[model samples]
Target: MNHVAPPGWPEQVRPPDAPEWERTAVGWLLDQCPPEYRGHTVLRRHPVALARLTAWHVEACQAGARRGLAEARTALRDALPMDAVEATIAALLTEQARLEGVRRAAGLVEVALRGRRFPARLPGLGSRHE
Candidate 1:
């Protein structure tokens, strides 16, 4: 029998909409740090950067908010201590908040449709991830 690629293969492993789906250590960093810093270049190149990012991830997770790990992970972006993704794919793929950021991200996707440097952060979108 021939085997055809199934739909939702990767998503089945980790659905996108399942809040906290991408809230792991690195995921958290990707969500918080600037989009420019989301590449392997930083984590792969700089040991200090990787360590710092990892440390922050742990800190965000271990703070203890009564919410279950899954819940906390999901809401990691809702009230994160750090800033969230400013990129469109990153935002849409990650389901970001902040109307302005969303608008900017959408605009970015329109222009680049997959380009670099799309805000990654705005001025007024603050204090949500606390």
Candidate 2:
């Protein structure tokens, strides 16, 4: 997946530049999110939710990288009743997975079409000098 850093995001996740307002955090997180989730209005309306979600995302990313994806997924799920941001991220991830599946299917179709148009040569199926 393409990862474009949000404008005004601190160089790192912690210290020095962490935002005080949940609204700010929400904006920052949205910037980092996929195009589909970037415009979600629920995040804008709920500051507390946004804050919790952002915190969870930061923790999950750090932990996932250090430990493993399964651990990260479990950790987030364990934080149940997730905030808007967390729920949004989860939804976005699911959407991303769905999109990836569609992309793969399209690629397979393309390969099949190409193969039909230009069949590959077999090494010994129809040898001329057998």
Candidate 3:
């Protein structure tokens, strides 16, 4: 059977075949760090920090989605509380807005290290390797 993504879901879900490290935020961060700085203690530790932040952000997003879904369900059963529904929608919108920023920040360290500007659009993020 074919799987269908829900409306507003991200176009790409997690890749089933990706390696464990490639599937994680810390690993992605570490892979993005500049080759020269990879040996530096601070740089080596950066991924761990980023991973923690990503985890928290993801949790917030998940919570927001859940709240929004519940609110929508409640609306179907009774008079919608517009305030609560709006708040939940706002939270989900905030999550979508911040995702790009997180992606950019994850690559900023490496871009700065390489003396290259971080593009408004992340280009060549995955192809970079020491």
Candidate 4:
């Protein structure tokens, strides 16, 4: 049977049942991490480890976006025009939204790597990874 991807699965990752799915997962996860992460053989060899690392990296990025959103107005009040500060705030909000999706996708991959399976018709199930 073909694999059924859970909600919030990353488009770049093949379904778990696909041949070499782990390799695809590793590639997608590594893309989410720093360039140095690719140098670590352990992460490439272990999908779960790479998933964990990717999740952590995405979380850090989300936190940074949150901090930037919180301080943008005040931090830029003197140095930038009000419109520019508002634009910065908008940009930070957009980044936060994007990071949220990345976090969800990474979490789903991580759980899948850990042997969690999702049924095809999980009605009313939220996208939150277990």
The TM-score that candidate 4 achieves is: 0.89
Runs of candidate 1 exceeding 4 Å displacement: 1-38, 64-130
Global lDDT of model 1: 0.35
Q: lDDT score, residue 21, model 4?
A: 76
lDDT, residue 108, model 2: 28
Highest-scoring model, TM-score? 4
Instruction: Name the runs in model 4 displaced over 4 angstroms.
Output: 122-130
Give per-residue CA lDDT, model 4, range 1-130, as digits (tens).
Answer: 6476887888888877677778888998998899999999988888898899898899999999989988888889999999999989999998899899999989988998999877775546733222
Would you estimate the TM-scores of all the predictions? Answer: 0.22, 0.31, 0.31, 0.89
Each candidate: what lDDT?
0.35, 0.42, 0.44, 0.85
Residue by residue across 1-130, what tens digits does model 1's lDDT show?
Answer: 1111122122211222234322332343344444666667756344345436544543443332222323544555555643442232244434333323433322322232122222222435431111
Estimate, for each residue in 30-86, the C-alpha lDDT of model 2 and write its tens digit. 544445765668766764454445445544544444453335456666565557447
Instruction: Compare the candidates by lDDT and give the number of the best one.
Output: 4
Which TM-score value belongs to model 1?
A: 0.22
Query: Model 3 segments beyond 4 Å from truth?
Result: 1-80, 110-130
Write down the worst ten-residue block by lDDT for model 1.
1-10
Worst-scoring 10-residue span by lDDT in model 3: 1-10
* Order of the predicted models by lDDT, top scorer first: 4, 3, 2, 1
Shift in Å, residue 101, candidate 2: 34
